[model samples]
Target chain A: MAIFYILLLFIITAAIIAVETKNLLSAVICVGAIGFGASLMFLFLRAPDIAITQIVVEVLGLIILIRVCISRELTFISGPREFFAVVVSVVIIFAIFLAGIKVLETLPAFGTPIFAEVPDAASQTYVEEGLRKTGAANLVASVILDFRAYDTLGEATVLFTAIIGATVILRKKTKKLLEEPDV
Target chain B: MKGMTIIVKIISGWVKVLIFLFGIYIILFGHLTPGGGFAGGVILASCYVLLMLAFGREFVEENLPLPLASKLDCVGALAFAVIAILGLVLGGSFFINFLYQKYLPGEALNLISAGTIPLSNLAIGLKVATSLFLVILVLSMFRPDMSGDKKE
Candidate 1:
């Protein structure tokens, strides 16, 4: 759709600005804009859950990034090596784009189910029997929480580990300070 | 960090409560709605972050102290584990919907009928909200050197 293209354009523009901006704060803001645009695209694609997650995660990430940026000098002018790296990345992106176009041509048209050629048994089962099995109105929630719960548990553990690591690493000085109060 | 202007503080004081309520609603209605534990938890964390931004770290800490946040984080994880362990005991499988068929009738689209799914969501929401708040709080506590020099 035209709206998708418009959102894509906005995303591309924001991403470029995020990458090219000298000021770290502006770059962070631009990155947030890109996230917003991408979440809108996700919404257009009818994945409301993904969109909500994406937007919320993006906001949280933006806040952390802004906090980090605030603790340091903002100007981040790219050096010659960084410019060269950018050029190399652009070339790689173009190559990938060309390859993707060729690959996409061989595939089904956009919005057409790729598994139409072969019956999507997995998704069909989830769609038809998911409610009966899980009793949740939201199929995605049922799938994640009930069906693929082990994966969710693993993700939760990962989050816990990450927080613990961060706390241990960042709180080292505070721990030392607390231990040696006389100093 | 010193907070923003008085106007921002006043507005955030009013807005934070609504944000927390909305987050709870999202978590509670997760099985029937788009948002689940993670999204709702992030929103809840954002409410706290907003309050911190508007009313300084000290004020925010006074309300939800670091120790309490840490305790909640542990409690959330423990709750989730206990649920999973219960499922294992009841259904012979980890994270099984054991309560769905036996105790609670499988009534479609009802809030209380989702069995352990809503319980899991609540646990995850609590864990995520507290952990995120802790991360932000700890990060904010650090007074990093702005001169690009390593701390001795």
Candidate 2:
């Protein structure tokens, strides 16, 4: 537990440094540090899959962000208003997620979330019958691919949409479009 | 963009194969191990990212090409969807483990005993690897104020 708190403290310090840094590249590296710190925390919590994911995602995101910061005149700075709006939007999104978790029965729930009251039906089913049903040693994989497969499909579609959006936005312009005067 | 120096190139060249193998191991043994599609896919993409860093973007892009990666991405997604649809049509439910009780029936904990999970992981792994590679490639190509709308 003390180690967990130390990891948390490290993450907080990195976050502060990330926010306070003058150099864009330093800030980006600090963000990566925070991600690695969180990944360590996840490992201590006995979730290696999430830890691996957090670390790789940190690497990928840092690569993208550093690419943007490199070879570009750094004039992008967010003011207090933009920060406040971002905070509000994030809070609202979390609230929506919380509401969805509260109302949706299909969403997975933990037995401890309700103070052990009634031992969550969905997760209980998974624990008792998941291995026998799916034949997969890793319950996480079985649950992700079998019982909640629609959810996996949704996630894949989301990724596809993001890639498509990035491609469309960053694609090179054709000759006709470039020859025409800027609209 | 020009790649890094000799040390980075030599080290990454030797290390990239091992990393690629590790990513494949993660995806293939996902049902038996900790990592699944997403983690393995990111690892695979990072392998390519390392190549891009060591050998330059122009060389990497020339090998993989944008259109081929895009098609592989679509193929991965389509394969996943088709698997789910097959379950619905054959087993009478969406995403059902039709093979678990039939052709895939065997002892538990084996590599090939996870029914559709390994297959799904393979598809998702392919999708994620190609999608992330495509996104990074496109983002790397982005040069603001080039021939497009002038931000100045």
| Candidate that would win on TM-score | 1
Docking class of 2: medium
- Chain B TM-score of all predictions, in order? 0.92, 0.92
Q: Please give fnat for model 1.
A: 0.65
The TM-scores of all predictions, comma-separated, are 0.89, 0.84
lDDT of 2 by residue, B1-152 (tens): 48999999999989999999999999999999899999999999999999998898888888887777878999999999999998988888989988886678657878878788899999999999999998887776665445255454
- Give per-residue CA lDDT, model 1, range B100-150, as digits (tens): 867785688888877889999999999999999988888877654323245
Interface RMSD of each: 2.8, 4.2
CA shift at A135, candidate 1, in angstroms? 0.6
Cα-based lDDT at residue B119, candidate 1: 93
Each prediction's fraction of true contacts recovered: 0.65, 0.84
What TM-score would chain B of candidate 1 score versus the native chain B? Answer: 0.92
Per-prediction count of colliding residue pairs? 0, 0
